[model samples]
Target: MRIDFSNWKPLTIREVNNIFSRISIYWGVAGGCALDMHLGRKTREHSDTDIVIFREDQQMVYQLLKNEWTLYKAKDGKLSLWLEGEYLDAVSDIWISRDNQSPWAFQIMLMDCEQGNWIYRREKTIKVSKEELFSTEENNVPYLKPAIQLLYKGGSSQIREKDFSDFQSVLPSLSLKEKEWLKEALKRQFPLGHSWMKSLED
Candidate 1:
């Protein structure tokens, strides 16, 4: 079910922490919110907050979230049950809420990783050391790097206006290495040509 609620209020960063901080799971901000967190400012309002968790740590997340929220497999624009202790073999996204009536609190991106290396889901060949996948703000909130977040947004042909805005804001601050990494990743995913690759070179 491509479900959306009438009172769909997103969780604030503080609210996000109030709930999940004690879970003891390897988690951090992802998506547009992450881009803003890395930039140390809120560029725009977010529809929902995204958090990344290792696929291996699914149980821990389930245990941490079970009592309060219902988890649903959000794939191909549809939502379904993400049962406890069940292997999330095909789905990589899960949406959490108190129930269908309430606003969605957050979404979880289940990522693949090995040892301490963070694997790029779109291109398995590309891997980044865990040390480089995320960085912390002055307030200690961890977020996905800008370049990586842009890489994810780049995959869709229907890239939203907000995503383009995020690219513009983040591109200038990206280091030479970060630019190069994003260029290479984009090249692999959009082999023919991608607008962002040219900008990255400049």
Candidate 2:
């Protein structure tokens, strides 16, 4: 679901914590904000904040925010109001806002998991344990690992300009293990002619 972007302002880190910290769910910052978190500083202006939450804990999020915010299911460029206690596996994104009059605060990208293993939605065969899915900063903020985030960014057939910039920003700090993992993942997903594969190799 989209909102009034005319006066849009992305939530700050403090705002993110205040809204979600108390909620009992396995979630972490994702997308551009997540890259900033891993770097321990904001590197650029964000159009919106992306947060990841497992499908299983979606109700927890719904329970916590239903009273104060309106929930809308966003999928395939369409928007629909999320019914209370209605869990649709097909819905991957949930947009939140105080009301129609309010600008959207944040978006929850629902993910699939099985027995503590993170199921790569794009490719179910690819899996990673929750431990590997995220890492915490000194301040206790959880964010998707930079390598994994970059994998997601580059996994697509066409890489966005922003993804290229983010990859460059985080490349210097990648551990040997991270680089290897991303390289292998790219191999599996792209198989051939993937633009990022060359960069990952060198």
Candidate 3:
């Protein structure tokens, strides 16, 4: 069976929650899809879910998702991949970082179910409950605080237009400290409010 979003059994936002109610794994709803999940918007069909598998307990992460999944990378007779799906575009390297500064790029197993047209662009962040925010799994997938999420997205100029718009959309909910942090983070990145130059200073 191809790991296709088209054929993917539509998992309700709530269902995703219930499934992980007690899984001892470090995971999060990441990628552009995550943005949509929170906003209750029509996210583009995803070939696979972007999960942040911590550097440790990787084997366990694989065992959990190995069902009908494909591996994207392999090392020393071991598989280091990203994605529980078998799609190539659906599969990507995992990056986990803190302080919005350091990101650890690692390979992961990606099972691509089908070919896709649009590469997902970022945007949309809904503040869900705390239970939804934390991962109970054994993996070390860390949750990106609203501040860090905004900071990281804003720092990257190559970020898709949708992602930048998403950042702006979530701007109102950002805490004062988050805004300040974003300002500093982006300023260091793009010479301080280069795009919304005034917004950063304000």
C-alpha positional error of residue 37 in candidate 2 after TM-score superposition, expressed in Å: 1.0
C-alpha lDDT of candidate 2 relative to the true structure? 0.82
Clash pairs (backbone) in predicted model 1: 1-79
Q: Any runs in candidate 1 off by more than 4 Å, and if so which?
A: 5-7
Report the C-alpha lDDT of model 3 over 14-97, residue by residue, as the tens digit: 444454434675455555545554444653554444454333435565555356334444333433444553333323353221
Residue-pair clashes per candidate: 1, 0, 18
Error in Å for residue 177 of model 1: 1.4
Best by TM-score: 2
TM for every model, in the order presented, reads: 0.92, 0.93, 0.51
The worst-scoring run of ten residues by lDDT in candidate 3 lies at 111-120
| Worst 10 contiguous positions by lDDT, candidate 1 | 1-10
Q: Write the per-residue lDDT of candidate 1 for residues 88-168, one digit (tens) a residue.
A: 967899888898677788889988988888887877887888777878778777778888889889867678888889899
- In the order shown, what is each candidate's alpha-carbon RMSD? 1.7, 1.7, 12.6
Could you tell which candidate, 1 or 2, scores higher by TM-score?
2
Candidate 2 residues 58-96, lDDT tens each? 888888888888888987877678999798799998777
Error of 1 at 43 (Å): 1.4
